[model samples]
Target: MGTFKFSMKMLIRDYKKSLFYGLTLVFAVAVSFVFFNIINNNQLADQSIAVGGGTWQNVQTPFSSILSFLIICFCCFMIFFANNFFMTRKTTELAVMGMSGSGYINSTMYVLYQTFVLLALATPLGLLLGRLVIPCSNAYMYERLHISKDVNIIPQEAYIYSFLLVAIVLAMICVLTAGYLHRNDILVLLSQEKEMNFHGSSNKYKPLLYVAIYVFGIVMMFMNPHSPNAYIAPTLVGVIGVVGMIRYVLPDVIKHLKKGVFLTKRYRLISISNLSYSIQRSLLLFTLMTVSVTGMMAILAANQQNPREFVTSVIGYIVVVLLLVVSIVYKLIMEAVTRKTLFFNLWKIGYTRKELKKIVKQEVIMYYAILILIPLVYILFIAGRFIYYGDMTISFAVIFTSAYVIPVILSGFLTYFEYRNAVVKPIQGGK
Candidate 1:
């Protein structure tokens, strides 16, 4: 009883951390519920619509097995990655408790209970959200797809399969956690974050290789955007390139920016110092976000000419991007909280509160610049295509840009406030 109680207490104490990563599980299960619902429903899957004015007809909309599979695969990875991230922090604390005479058994139990809490939090909410989302566009879906049948019945498999996915993720987390706790290497495992010496990778040829892959993937995606294998494959490749470039090429770019005349401002250098690490950690996350939004953007561009399909694409864009925004907001909040120590150290070094505020603002802007601008450029390029081909109006380009930017702007606001509360004000209060 005492052991379980202690575990529960630890979880509650760090509930913010739990909640931050819980967004991942919620999204994971939600995507599962959604994709499974679509996949299991024959009418929704087979419905056909028209495309290309008075030309080749018999076109269909975006929902397909390949897209579903890609989404499911991506969600699975998100769950696994989130699990590892949570346990990496949690187990280290558990090891400390063990050192304080709490025993290894208690440590193990905490891992179990933590996973249970995640399962409990993610399953029902994800399913409920997913169930709700299916009907959001359904009324128009039949009209858009030109189908007579309602196809409005929610699939039972969405609930069953969503829970099943959550279960599998929980199981994997436990197995992985068990292996780590057994080895007892918690404290020494990931001290790289503590160490600040980052000698940018010496390999010059490899970064070019990543850029080449990035260009190739982007080009391939535009060339054959309709083919499922082509779209999903290039996206996978592009993500690798984006992640690799962020991990490898970006550091080198930052190093040059710091030395070059472009970043001559002294204050900006402080932002650079902080950005160097945060961006590195954000590699896969921002890249994955790019894929999610851009995938929907591709649909938007392809369907820009059709009114119904365009509406469908916009709704799809909102759903996919907003799901990611939830994760991004949680992430920004957590970063502010976690980097409190770094901010305090800056405060101790004779940096005033105003300067600290500037640093926070600079970091937030720079983060958005990197996170939003890359994808925005790509999205704009996508929007530009329809304009060039005469399938879309300039206003649609504005609409496309607006859809992606609005949530990002809102996110930037949230990031600023969280940083103030978690880092800036606390420092002012002499903590």
Candidate 2:
């Protein structure tokens, strides 16, 4: 009991330090929930009206699945970074606890306590904020459409369930992180290495693959912008190709940092390194940006009173998807090149294979799920369906296909790389 109390106090202190990250995460989740609720509500109403009073609950499964994925993926990254931060700050303290009378169980309890308190604070507020936004957003949409909605936000249920779910998931991540720390090598805890090593480089021919994927995705996006289902296949293929190439290129690009052809080469190397890290650490962010931009274009295009209003919405979605496809492809190529450079630099700095693997694994996991999966699923299912049912076009169908398939492949590829880097590399080093 005393230990638990002490651990809870420590957890509070640590959580205070993590306030910035936690607050931002909570805000993002809240806003996303609100947006999702609005979109889901709109879709359900539309479908219900079409079916003449069919239950909205039937159509909610997909939306709920998407929400679950987002919460899990987001929490995973948050925990990874938070745990990493915690471990770095408390290595010596943890080491001392292990050496003294305190056991690993006591330490693990603290991790759980901290995670629970964080979620306890964050989830209710998120639900409340989401509840507040839904009504306002619905009012705007209703006024714009000049129609009334029969259904309204279930704030109470949403608040209770979502808060509980997210809390449990985050707490699980905390447990895993604590378990890892508890089993950490004493030597690693004693004098932890700063530098990270990586030995991979990019292939020159990879640019062609990236270009091909981008071009194909563009073609699909333009061919049938209105048909959401049609766009799925092309989007999938393009995304997969881009992810693979980026995975290959990102590490090397950071390694071969040299003066560019232009005269403004003073901070080029630093810029390149930072950009590379961002790409590797935040690929999901870039993807979300693309999805969000495209969605915005769709909404705006749909609203225009101009001559091309009808045509524009359809075209706008396609155009935005194409733009996203191109950006992702380009980023992948650049990231692959950058990673190669960074890996070589790490080697030069005498970072061990095991240490580098851990960093890369953490980074890859962070980028793949949070940046990629959550937004991709939301765009593909919720937004894709909206665009598809609204109008079926060849371009949209192609983009939708690409979007769906790409993330699955990317998830696998990134996971493989992460496992190879984190698990395999360490084992090989030990051998």
Best by TM-score: 1
TM, every model: 0.81, 0.54
Each candidate structure's count of clashing pairs: 0, 55
Scored against the true structure, residue 335 in model 1 reaches a CA lDDT of 57
Candidate 1, position 300, lDDT = 61
How well is each residue in 1-431 modelled by candidate 1, as lDDT tens digits?
77778778878988876875677777778777877766565455533322223211233434454456566767787677667667655655775676677766677777788778777987888887877777755556656756676555776766787777777777777788777778765455344223344566788787888888878877875787443234566666777788878877877777788888547675687787677777776676788788877677666666555544455456546656766666666656665666778878888887888888998889888887788876765566555665666756899778767877888888888888887788888875553
Instruction: Report every candidate's CA lDDT.
Output: 0.70, 0.50
After superposing candidate 1 on the true structure, give the runs of residues whose Cα lies further than 4 Å from its correct spot. 45-63, 101-106, 146-152, 180-184, 189-199, 204-241, 260-264, 303-316, 390-397, 428-431
Q: How much does candidate 2 score in TM-score?
A: 0.54
List residue ranges in candidate 2 displaced over 4 A. 1-16, 28-44, 47-54, 57-96, 99-102, 145-155, 187-216, 219-226, 250-266, 287-431
User: Model 1 Cα RMSD, Å?
Assistant: 5.3
Candidate 2 positional error at 219, Å: 4.6
Give the 10-residue window scoring lowest on summed lDDT in candidate 1: 48-57
CA lDDT for candidate 2: 0.50
